[model samples]
Target: MAAPITAALLIIGDEILSGRTKDKNIGYIAEYLTGVGIDLCEVRIVPDVEDEIVAALNSLRQRYTYLFTTGGIGPTHDDITADAVARAFGVGIDHDPRAVAMLRERYQPHELNEARLRMARIPDGADLIENPISKAPGFKIGNVFVMAGVPAIMQSMLDTIAPTLQTGARMLAETIEAEGLAEGNYAAGLADIASAHPGVSIGSYPSFSTSGFRNQIVVRGRDPVAVARAVAAVQDLLHRLKSDGVPH
Candidate 1:
């Protein structure tokens, strides 16, 4: 079987760290990558600082099959992602005719000021990723994809780039709920089951609501048969605990 395709996310902007603007892209991107058979292994949120962005980009792009960045590509002064990306790749960056053409569709000659023209600057040898919603285009250089900060525009860019990415075997998951059960009671047994099934990943999540406490065990694996075996093991463990009159 081919190795699992993996990716990382780099979220850029001061507003996200300051909590001035809540981030709505990470979860969406995670789910989207999962559906297309790409595992999102890591995520990092960095400020608008060029060095920070460059460092994170260099690390993630080399560590994974793809590195997706969101935010910091805008008309404002703080949007330095393009420059950082260029520096990270040791490439020259300038106003690209293709990007400028795309922007021209939305902005007239008089409207395209210096600040607004900042959107047209792209790294050397990078391919443009179309933005259907806004005329401004995103660029992909090597394994890194630089997208807009706005949720809508980022999502649109993802759709445009999805077809170009190579995918791996899709991960399968099974969820078993342990009603009125506490995680501590089943923690040891879950660990044992996980050790037995090296191919599967098992996680236990606990939640408390006004009604009471509830626990859920999720098993994920690329092999459906292995996932099923892990699920059965978990269920059997739960049954044995219940038979022992263990308080949930």
Candidate 2:
């Protein structure tokens, strides 16, 4: 199998860290990347300070195939993600005519104040990612993609950038519902199975409710045969534990 294409997410906003603005992008981006055969390996939420954003950007962009950032691209004074990105790449940032034109589509000449024009700032040599909703374009420089903080706009930008990404082997997964089985009864056996099938990853998830514990074992891998074999082993383990009178 080819090496997996990996990505890291940098969520930038003082509002998120201060608990004033709840984040809705992390899970959305994670699932999106997974569906498109890109592995999202790490995520970081940083404050709006330019230094903090620049530091996180440099670190993540170097380690992953791509780095995605949401927040701090707005028109407000606190929106410093673009400047941080420019400094991180050692590139100059200025008002790009393309981005300015996009913003013009939404705002009239008189309404395009200095504050609103801040959204038109783009790093040198970056390609603009279109925003159909608000007309403020996100940008891609090197491997770092800067996007809006709003979930809807970020999702739209993701759609625009999807086709440009290089994907890898799609992960295959199987969920074995061990409804009546407790995780403790199967932990050791599952570990053994996981060790036996080196190519597949096995995980146990249990949720509690008024009825009690609902358990599930998920086997995941890039290879279908490997995932299937691991799933069968998990099922057999559950069966044996049931026969041996293990607690529910």
Candidate 3:
């Protein structure tokens, strides 16, 4: 099998860090990447500081197959992600004619002030990611994709770049509802099954409601046969425990 495609997300903005703006992009991006068979390995939220953004950008870009950054590529003084990305990659940054043209479609010549033109500044040699909503393009330099902070625009940008990304083997999963079974009753058995199936991952999720505890065991793996084997073992263990009249 080919090596797994991995990615990391760097969320940049003081508003996110300060709780001024709640984040909705992380979960969306995670699910989207998962569907495309790219594992999102890590996520980091950093302030608007250029140095901090540069450090995180350099670190994550080197560590993962791809690094996606959202927030800080806007029209304000605090929007410094482009500059930091250029700095991290040791490249020059300036207003790209393509980006400026895209922005001009939404903003009139007179309305294209310095603040708004800030959105046109892109890293050298980077490909522009079209923004269908606002027309202020995102950019891809090296393995890093710099996107907008706004959730809607960020999602659109992700959609635009989806076709270009590399994907690995799709992860398969099976869920066994252990409704009347408590996790403590099956932890050891689950561990044994997990050890038996080294290629698969087994996890138990328990939720509490007024009635009692509801447990769900999830088996996941890149190999479908491995996942199925693990799921069967977990089901057998749960069935045996229930037959023995183990209490929830």
Candidate 4:
């Protein structure tokens, strides 16, 4: 049987929930997963606590085809992702020699301290995910991929892993910008269009101009043919609006 292409994100940290940091990874991950045809079912944010991490790990990993965890893997006092994964999986976490060796090669003798190598710990039988920006590698335990929290590093890691992921057809998006129209005026028509095309995601974004509000109706779907047809219909609807030609 083919492995299912469903995924979930476990964002771990106290900083995120406490509002010390705004979680940027969730949005990026959602977009990335959508692009790769993996349906992102859920997003959970847990504190740096071990028990909390363990619970989230167990729940998400078991439920989703692929579980991606962010944060709590740094070389700091708070980093608890490795230990949590071990507990969740009913296994032991050990400092892998390969990870240690990589760290040794990257850092100067004095720089590679014991605390810095805290990232070397990995669950038994897990594979390491490549980290180009920083030598501290992320690892995969079964279907769970542990990645960095930082946007740049996370993006790089995602790029490396994305090619190996199974993705369906790319989603097609059609956007037509209308010069002058209030969102309220088009909301009903957009709702009708949205209902007509169940598979398509239609949106109306309104922007203000010198004249008045301008609405851009965007329609998107996985099927290109359906999107194109919907887009033409939207254009035809817009043409009938019969706007007053105000001199610029």
Candidate 5:
């Protein structure tokens, strides 16, 4: 079987770090990539500093099949994502005619001031990712994709880039709820099952709510058969634990 395609996300914004702006793009992008057969393997949140963005961009873009960056591409003064992306690739960035034309469709000549024109900048040799909601275009350079921070715009850009991405086998997943069972009780058994099925990934997640505490075991893999086998093993482990009256 072919190896799974992987991607990483770099979320850049001072507002996110400062808790001024809440992030809503990560989950959306993760589901979108998963549905399209690309695994989102890693995610990083960085401040709006140019150096930090450039460093993170360089690191992630090289390590993963694709690197997606969100935030820091707006028209504001702190929107330095484009410049940082150019520096990372050692490429020249300027107001691209294509991006300018796209922006022009939304903004009149008099309204296209210096601040708004900043949205037209594109890195050299990069392809523009279309934005249906807003006129500002995202860009793709090498394996790195730069997009907006706003969830609506980011989702739109993702749709635009989806066709261009090289996808692998779509990952399959199974979820089993071990209600009234604690993760610690199944940790060892889950480790053994994961070891036996090397192709599948097993994870135990515990959640506490106003009603009570519950644990859910999720098994994921590229192969449906492997995932099913892992899920069955997990169920069997849980059944034995329940029968043994193991402490929850």
Candidate 6:
């Protein structure tokens, strides 16, 4: 059996909590992790407070194989992700010489102030995650990767660290779309089919249509053969239902 690689996302921004800014990182990272054979199991949105951020970081970092955080590591006063991360790990946060030098090389003296230098403050013994869109880099302490608030910057930083992360066997999914079918009618058969295929994950999607209700079932598994078997099993269930005088 292949080992499971689970991931969690921590969105650190009061804007998301207050509904001022819609959080897009969770969905984006979830898709990315799924593409790379990592399952994203949990996502949390925390405010700018130090205690809350530290507690969330500590909880998620140890619980999952990989923990990803976005937002709050910015030039502004409320950006305290770095400080909170350091506190969570019980390490002191300081401006790395390399990061400082990189910042100095990229920006003029006036642009490099206390606020801007805050970006360079990384937790001790942490590796840096490169930000292609923005010069300010993100850092990885233990399993937690602290990234930027901007979607573009966060995405680019994720790309740099994804290669180093451990991934599970890629899951294969087969989608079956049936028109004008009520999910309630298919429930018993669906349950039986799913029970037969223990390795497969079967999900039923229902939607409203002009003709009637529509149902789409997707069967997913890490093993290709098992996924195919499960799809066949679902098809057999549908065929049996149709044969029993149920209009599908």
* Candidate 4 lDDT over residue span 6-50, tens digit each: 889999999999999988899999999987788788999999999
Clash tally for model 3? 0
> Each candidate's root-mean-square deviation in Å?
0.8, 0.8, 1.0, 3.5, 1.3, 1.6
True-vs-predicted CA distance for residue 227, candidate 5, Å: 1.7
Candidate 2 structure quality by residue, lDDT tens digits, 67-172:
9999999999999999999999999999999999999999999999999999999999999999999999999999999999999999999999999999998888
Question: What tens-digit string does per-residue lDDT give for candidate 6 at 49-119?
Answer: 99999999989988999899999988999999999999999999899987787678778999899989999
Best of the candidates, lDDT: 1
Evaluate model 5: give its TM-score. 0.95
lDDT of 5 by residue, 1-248 (tens): 99889999999999999999999988989999999999999999999898899899889998899999999888999999999999999999999999999999999999999999999999999999999888899999999999999998998888888999999999888999997678888888889999999998888888888988878999999888889899999999999999999986
Report the Cα lDDT for candidate 3: 0.94
* Superior candidate under TM-score, 3 versus 5: 3
Q: Give the higher-lDDT candidate: 1 or 3.
A: 1
- For model 2, the superposed segments whose C-alpha errors exceed 4 Å read none
Candidate 3: the clashing residue pairs are none
Q: By lDDT, highest first, what's the ranking?
A: 1, 3, 2, 5, 6, 4
TM agreement with the true structure for every prediction:
0.98, 0.98, 0.97, 0.85, 0.95, 0.94
Clash-forming residue pairs, model 6: none
The lDDT per prediction is: 0.94, 0.93, 0.94, 0.84, 0.92, 0.88
Model 3 TM: 0.97
Off by over 4 Å in 4: 1-4, 207-214, 243-248
**lDDT value, residue 59 of candidate 5:** 91
- Clashing residue pairs for model 4: none
**For model 6, what is the alpha-carbon lDDT of residue 99?**
79
Extract clashing residue pairs from model 2: none
lDDT of 1 by residue, 1-248 (tens): 68999999999999999999999999999999999999999999999999999999999999999999999889999999999999999999999999999999999899999998999999999999999988989999999999998999999999999999999999898999987568989999999999999999999988888988878999999998899999999999999998889996
Q: What is the per-residue lDDT of model 3 for residues 1-248, given as tens digits with 9 covering 90 to 100?
A: 78999999999999999999999999999999999999999999999999999999999999999999999888999999999999999999999999999999999899999999999999999999999999999999899999998999999999999999999998887889997887899999999999999998899999989988889999988988888888889889998999999987
